[model samples]
Target chain A: MYKIFLTFILSILLLPYSSTFAVEVDMLIPPSDFQAFDTPNDDGKSVTLRWPSSPSESTEAEYVVYASLRKNGPFTTEVLRINSKTMYEEGSDSNFHYVEIKPGKFFNKDSDVTGGRSSYFFRLVMMSNSENVTVNEIASATPKGNWFNWKKLNNFIILIAFSTLVLWFIEHAKKNPNLYLRKISGLDAIDDALGRATEMGKPVLYVHGLNGMGSISTIAAVNILGRIAIRVAEYDTTLKVSNIDPIVLSVSQEVVKESYLEAGRPDAYVEDNVFMAASEQFPYVAAVSGIMIREKTAANFFMGYFYAESLILAETGASTGAIQIAATDSYTQLPFFITTCDYTLIGEELYAASAYLSREPLLLGSLRAQDIAKGIIITALVVGAALATIGIGFISFIFKAS
Target chain B: MNFFKRTIPLIIAFIMGIMMAFQYYVPHEASQSLLKVVTRWGITIAGFAVFIGAYSLFHLHWNKIKRKVPGWGYSTFVFFGAGITIIFGLYNGGEFFLHDKQEGTMFDWMYFNVQVPAGATMFSILAFFMASAAYRTFRARTSEATILLIAAVIVMLGRVPVGALIWEFLPPIADWIMSVPNMAAKRGILIGVSIGAIATSLRIIFGIERAYLGGGD
Candidate 1:
């Protein structure tokens, strides 16, 4: 009796820490038709989906559907809350449950299918009462694919036009062999910011964004960091390159150290200057914000991908009156940076800045090619608009004519 | 030597880039196998790089602790956190439930419960700061500022129940502002941004941008 009492007390104490018993329930929606609608509405392929409603469906809760591109994917994750259209009748035995699968945007003009032409694994899960749990999943579903992306006609034309412009520019560059100059305000400010730091006898801080080395934007940031490090080495001024991503941090350390070595200032390279502040996002932001305030960093160089923290960093820099030079490929935060920073590189301009500053032949040539692509795109747009106004099928004619 | 240094990575990049590009259009089993091999090698190389990062981290913090730096105590905390997690992870070798699950381990506990919450706390604090900053910085200083301030106010008001009660037209106004004017501006910006990205990619692919390859004289 004493042993039993002790066991009961121990179990009660462990109850909160112990994992909750997961209730498994299977939820099904009715059979739906997957149709192809290129020429017209036609029967094509089929897909079946089964989801488990919440462990308790009759209770006050709803479910959302998620589909992944593959068996294990960067899942087709949507944050939209969708309620269960069909619920099990507690007292009735019904095998056939009618489900109204809403027409997704991927479908062209009231087509009864979702977008993309890949096998997707779908799961139905509930999100309510501070608990999110997956209820049921269909192992596979293939959305019908139509070859012609009619909806993306605008994008297709733009691509073709841009490719043409880029090719044209490449050819023009090859023939002329002349240096093409493009304005980059951020590149111009690099020297000014560095000079300010040099005069003030204060350090410059460089953040290589919040992405891993695998990201293209991080590569751009690292490239820019190398340039700044070289300048720092030459000036014999301090340059602290803080990184959030571990892999990028390693690469950045190498890049900065190499830059210093090349600048004939191998002794000036401090290991602590190139530090990795955690892999997490906002923590890195806090660390950076703290560093900016603590160091009284005269210049803040922000280059790469940034999200909500972009403005926070920029605003803090503004507060400090640092010559903030920010370049990012992110469109969302570009406006904020522009409003706050002294020099802001918009989108591809970040990439262009590196090329303009470095002027490597490959970079120049590619820039030239890309320009040609853009010109071609503009020409196509002009031609397409004109043809539409005149009621002629100019784009189709061009495709067929080619 | 110059030829080798410049052309080698460029050649490799081009070949890899082109191969990957073509593989997307091709539907061959051999191509698929090649892609799989490339992906596997990429992942392996990435894993090795991660190992290098871990080593660097160890070296940096170990030196700090040895030198008795101000934050040396934190270094000890990190070492213990990392060591205990690794020790427990390898000891049970998946036999124990605690060791079996990745999240069940101590590292995950520190990561999810402690580190993640600390990070989230920092992130959520931004919401309050944004409101304050918006009010201060977005005062009608100019035409653009006035327009921005008005739009922001409308959007903020439209998102709440009180705004709908005060003005029924506010919701539709907010929707129109977001979907039409905002969307148009966003689309324009997106297109412009994509153009820039493509240009940059072409430069890297062709080997014009060697600054990323680590700049030297």
Candidate 2:
């Protein structure tokens, strides 16, 4: 009887251990609703997995995802490990979990999809700290591709609308060709500055800031250059165009040449008049500053986009007592131009300067369309603010970038 | 000649611009691949274009030196700088830029010790320029100038410890000025810039603006 009592006590101590090992009590339960499918709006290289809510935060089981090329075979290939507490995040589905399976290299080597659409088999595993584990059944899903990104549909719609507006305006302007544009003070000074340079018998220095042809500011500056070149050619005044970008220099040369030809003064065109000053930023500024000082130009037109070098150029030009007119879309540099130069084109005025100078139907049309678009945007902003204040917040989602 | 110089470029520009613009909305792998291909093409073309810049720079200096023009001595420095940089760069084991450039060479030494410091020095000069500019801007010559000066002083004070020492409300006032008024003005300019950019882009894509392609009808 004593021996039986000792055995009972020993069995009680080992009962928890034996039951855990022998009976195979699962440390974690496989979450329900576990399934896999194709990932949307991707390049066909990813799959997505979904499952029901995690068991409990108190349970220290980690959700391990396994992917296989075949169904019902060795499901040992691991994919991802998700914490149980992650599923309990605020606003997230308290009853559901979803994970995207981007099987890049692993499935490329061991995938089991046949001649049919490419498919992958996936399963969920719940593992505890004690090294005990449980798994859900395998589910198959296909990874697919789509042509258009529906997420960016709003952006696409805006682009189409704006393009149509611009084209329509261009057609209208072509028919009428008498569209009115507001006076840009800096542009107004352009002809006066060129004429002043002629009267003074000193060159007009046109400095294209350190931007390449890709920049819209540089393009606008070059257009303005064309107009200025025409005036320079007509007035029989020397014009100097300094550039930091080789491509811009090439284009400037051609533009100036064409302008001179159009002015019926082709013989007056000089290739050296437009040349690359320097490639590096500070060096370019230094070189142009040196030119301004040495030549003592009568007029200086600082156009295109500028960075910190703006102040240095404008300051040096101011010291030279040149009739300076500045135009740029870089608003940060506007204050410098406004303070030092005789006149400054702020923001959109720089873009509009080309249209205003050329008075071309196509460009003026585009500029007019831009003004209309700005009005629409302002209206949208006011409406959006009112809607948001009134508790309708979905309007903001329309403007959100995907 | 006109066709090669003008029409072909316009056609190519239109096709490329339209393709690139619309490609932003495509999620397919082919669209991405096309972008990569086009980017590589652009880089290659720009690589070839660099020679043009180098040629123009050298030709300008050469003409200056030939003419014995005033300040001709400065033109010689350009040649010296370019020559030294190129020679050392090649010496740094790039196989004349055919292979990877190794470190601990004269090229790296010149770039780190010379170019970097000079560039930094040039940038540092902007502080003095800013001070002078601020002085000019803060002068209360008009009603507008007075308002600007007050705002500048408030912002300057609120940003430092002395501001809190002077007045507790100063910081909040400065914050309001930056967050509300400053942000509003900046956003207005940004909106204008965006719309103007779109207008300019459309003009180029449609071949309406030909000045950038060297001024034509």
Candidate 3:
């Protein structure tokens, strides 16, 4: 026992050293001080880029170099993506992938991004090992200057205006809010669907999507389910909600129980009604779809984020001619839904449906704020454009003269 | 009405959201350091939520087994699968299959034999179902139907090798339809979608959307 304990202590002490691994990558050619001038190519909208590779590189499968206009680029912005090259094939190695920054691929878009005001920076990344792991940071011959667009005045003005509008609307909606969002047809039909299920003595089927938590659509579906559960409880109608995620299943159970208690029909609430169907996607789909067929559900509500399985569930419900109110944020599945379901909440409309159903003041207020923000953006664009066109001289002169 | 139930979680969520949003732009060390702490705490909380979820499942299944419900047999299967999976996973360095017993590994067997086949089957069924659905639904009874039918035919043919074999024009025509008309419609829908998302997010941020807080109307 003492020997074992000593060995454990010694191993624990040596763990950090055993695990310590460092990777260093460097470029050999043109050195760190190489310079390349921005020469106006005959192909007006083009600029050439060349970089050196690391000398003492290990057995790397390939090298990929990335370039951005800024040193620390705002990659989220569309401006930086105009001609972003992800794959830069290495020279001399036919098997190695490389980027040849030539015409048609990354230049000459007839935009205002020419005339030598653009600055570009490049980075070299090494990928080696069987797992295709990326190792060490490598730099290119510093950032270089490139051309710019003179006609970018309009685009700049529009961006400024839109930003202002969104900000203004956000602030305005926070105070003095008078927003009216339209009702969702699918949500409006819920009461009738639930009532029909009650009359027919059949369970109201609810599938709270097959997506994980960070999804806005899943949250919206859960919100709708809460309202539906309250109605079902009040009418003493049997409600079955099948979930793919265990977390979601637990939440659905709580939501159902709370709704029943709120409706003063706690005795009618059944724990088995809300269940975790399965973790695997198709299995969950088969189980839920099978349950719908077996139980002979009168009303089927498919709400939330869904994938290809959306069609299977929706079509199965359609075959039964059940009052199907299917809503999904997955754009690909929308075509299937629009053709099959009685009422379908298209894309963003599905996001707003829960708010409409639950007329909770916050949702209504937020909708109003968003509209206001959009209006503010439009106005800012108009004003910025007018200022930019009338004269950069006038705008700059005003600041300078002051 | 309690502070813990109502105000605290919302306040935390709002603060976290704003902090995360600002962290994208702010480069200060203090902000970055705080962001890391918040992120770690958030991850820990998420881990706890996972445990809670597993516990709920365990509790429910345990009750079913104890009561000897109608689906008690299925409960036994579930219990065995979960128990075996966990045991194998632990033995395989906290993975889902045994390391030493590669062929008989539970995860490899289930994933290959069950998950992959089921997923592939579901995907393959789509092709047959799409054909049947199109045949039944793509009648040119109305102007909309005619348009849809034409678009569907062009899309179906243009995607395959035979369309190029039949007519070179088919490819260009399909490309034009997809790029110009389809793109325009998709863009319009996208703009509307973004607007709705922004509106909804704004509502949530501004405390206008309480439906998520269990404030069911």
Model 3: per-residue Cα lDDT over A1-402, one tens digit each? 999999999999987765543332333121122223333312222334433333323444354445555456422221111111233335544322233342224323343232533444455444444322222332222212223332343443543454445556546645645556666787788888998999999999998777865566777777778778888988888998888776677667877877887788889888877877677778777777877886789999988888888878877777776899988777778888877778888877777676666664445554554456556545644676588887644444322310
lDDT of 1 at A41: 15
Score candidate 3 by TM-score against the native: 0.66
lDDT of 1 at B198: 61
Give one digit per residue, the lDDT tens place, for model 1 in B45-83. Answer: 777776665666677779879999765776786678678
The backbone clash count of each candidate, in order, is 14, 0, 21
Error of 2 at A106 (Å): 3.4
Cα lDDT tens digits for candidate 2, A1-402: 999999999999998998666323444445666778777777677888777774533346578887777786577778888776565424566666767767655656444556655667877777666554455467888776778888898888888998999999999998999998877777888889988889899999999977888788888889889888888999999999999988888889989998898889999998888988888898888889899999999999998999989998988888898999998888788888888889988888877877788888988999999999999989989999999999998878877788
- What's model 2's overall lDDT? 0.83
**Candidate whose DockQ is highest:** 2
Which candidate's TM-score is highest?
2
**Chain B TM-score (each prediction, in order):** 0.84, 0.93, 0.76
Worst-scoring 10-residue span by lDDT in model 3 chain A: A76-85
Whole-structure CA lDDT of model 1: 0.68
- C-alpha DockQ for predicted model 3: 0.18
TM-score of each: 0.68, 0.89, 0.66
Q: Per-model i-RMS in Å? A: 4.7, 1.7, 7.4
Q: How would the candidate models be sorted by TM-score, starting from the highest?
A: 2, 1, 3
Cα error, residue B205 of model 1, in Å, equals 2.0
* Candidate order by decreasing DockQ: 2, 1, 3
